[model samples]
Target: MDTGTLALLIPIMALSIPLFRIWTKHQKEIAEMEVAKTAERAAQYAASNKELEDRVAVLERIVTDRGYDIATQIEALRDTREVEGLTARSESGIN
Candidate 1:
């Protein structure tokens, strides 16, 4: 209302504007830093997941190979038993 009061208020308001701008700029910088950190963490998680997947694939291959080997051995044992039975029957002249 008075000239002196108006003069003081104008300078205070002008100074406050720049201070507010500085505060907002710092907040934006902090938000950007947080985003960057989150992205880095996500990338690390993805890499770890990929490594685990690769390890599982290798284990699966090994298990499949071992299973096939075991199956082949079992079949060979069955064939050998049958052959032995046939030989014993023939030698004893039993049908």
Candidate 2:
């Protein structure tokens, strides 16, 4: 209200301006760092998702490829087992 009080307040006001600027600058830097971290995490997630998709594609091929012939594979395995059993019985001379 008085000239003396106004004179004293000017220096404080000037100091506060610089302090506020520094605080806001640090806040902006921190926000930018968080943005960068979020982007990195998103990239990692995308890479992981792509890897999973590739694995699923391989599994799909294994299941759907005609060369995999599930019935024929099972029949071949059964034949081998029967042959082994018959051979074992003959070797033991058991009917």
Candidate 3:
């Protein structure tokens, strides 16, 4: 209402505008950094999930695919090792 009061209020309000702008800018920058960090974490999780999916796919194939006939091969290999062990023991005169 008075000229003296208006003069005092004007400078205070002007100074507050710049301080408000600085505070808002600082908050915006911090929010952007948080968003970026969250996005990075999400990307890492996605990559880890993809790798696990790939490993699961390989395990599924090993379990379900019957074309390899792995059981017979393993048995044959075991028989071969037994024969070799016998031969080695006889050569060494160890019974």
Candidate 4:
């Protein structure tokens, strides 16, 4: 309203604008950090999943090479009544 009040208010308003900008910038930095962390965690999960897939492929190959049938193996594992060991044995005492 008056010259003195206007002079005081103008400097205060100018200082508040810089403080608001600084607060917003800090918030933006924090949000960016959170996004980066989430991306890193997602990458780690993807790597672990890929490793598990590779290990599964290796196991499948080993099983096939040992003359073990995949379908038969899955059926035998699904059978709750059977008490078969990890290694399958034929009726003639051969693996």
Candidate 5:
């Protein structure tokens, strides 16, 4: 209410206005940077998820195909032949 106090308060209030604006501006910049970082991380996660989905789809196709069992049986027969051939070669000492 007194002139002395009013004069003192006036200059303090004037100085605080710019300081508050600067503080708020810095905080807003920090928030924007965090948002950008979050978006980049989300994009990376999406790409990884898509790659995994593709791999899963390929595996599902292989597993569900009717020919898969036949293919596995053929591979087993080939493996048995290879093993028997190795055993025969070892027995005959044909290194």
Candidate 6:
């Protein structure tokens, strides 16, 4: 209502507009960065899933193939471990 009060209010209003604009711009940039990070993480998960699927396919093939001999291979691995255990025990005089 008075000229003195009006003069003070004018500068305050003028300064607030630019500060609000700057704050909104900062918020927009943060949102964009979060979106980019989320997309990158999604891509990494997809690649990992693809690798696991490939490994599973290989395992399925090995298990289904007639000549693979899964039982024999497993027994062979167990035998090697038992032989190593016996050798270590004998060397340590643990009977």
lDDT of 3: 0.96
Off by over 4 Å in 2: 71-95
**How does model 6 fare in lDDT?**
0.96
List model 2 lDDT by residue over 1-95, tens digit each.
Answer: 99999999999999999999999999999999999999999999999999999999998887888666977889999999999999999999997
lDDT by residue for model 4 (1-95), tens: 99999999999999999999999999999999999999999999999999999999999888879775777878877784354532345554765
Order the candidates by TM-score, highest first — what do you get?
5, 6, 3, 2, 1, 4
Question: In model 5, which regions exceed 4 Å deviation?
Answer: 67-95
- Please report the candidate that would top TM-score against the real structure: 5
Which should have the higher lDDT, number 5 or number 6?
A: 6
lDDT winner? 6
The per-candidate count of clashes, in order, stands at 0, 0, 0, 0, 0, 0
lDDT of 6 by residue, 32-63 (tens): 99999999999999999999999999989888
Residue range 1-95, candidate 5, lDDT tens digits: 99999999999999999999999999999999999999999999999999999999988887788656968888999999999999999999997
TM-score result, candidate 5: 0.75
Name the Cα RMSD for model 5: 3.4
Q: Candidate 1 at residue 59, lDDT?
A: 85
Model 2 lowest lDDT segment of ten: 62-71
lDDT of 3 by residue, 1-95 (tens): 99999999999999999999999999999999999999999999999999999999998897688656878889999999999999999999999
Off-target runs (Cα >4 Å) in candidate 3 are: 67-95
Model 5 pairs whose backbones collide: none
Which should have the higher lDDT, number 4 or number 5? Answer: 5
Q: Using TM-score as the measure, name the better of candidate 2 and candidate 6.
A: 6
Total colliding residue pairs, candidate 1? 0
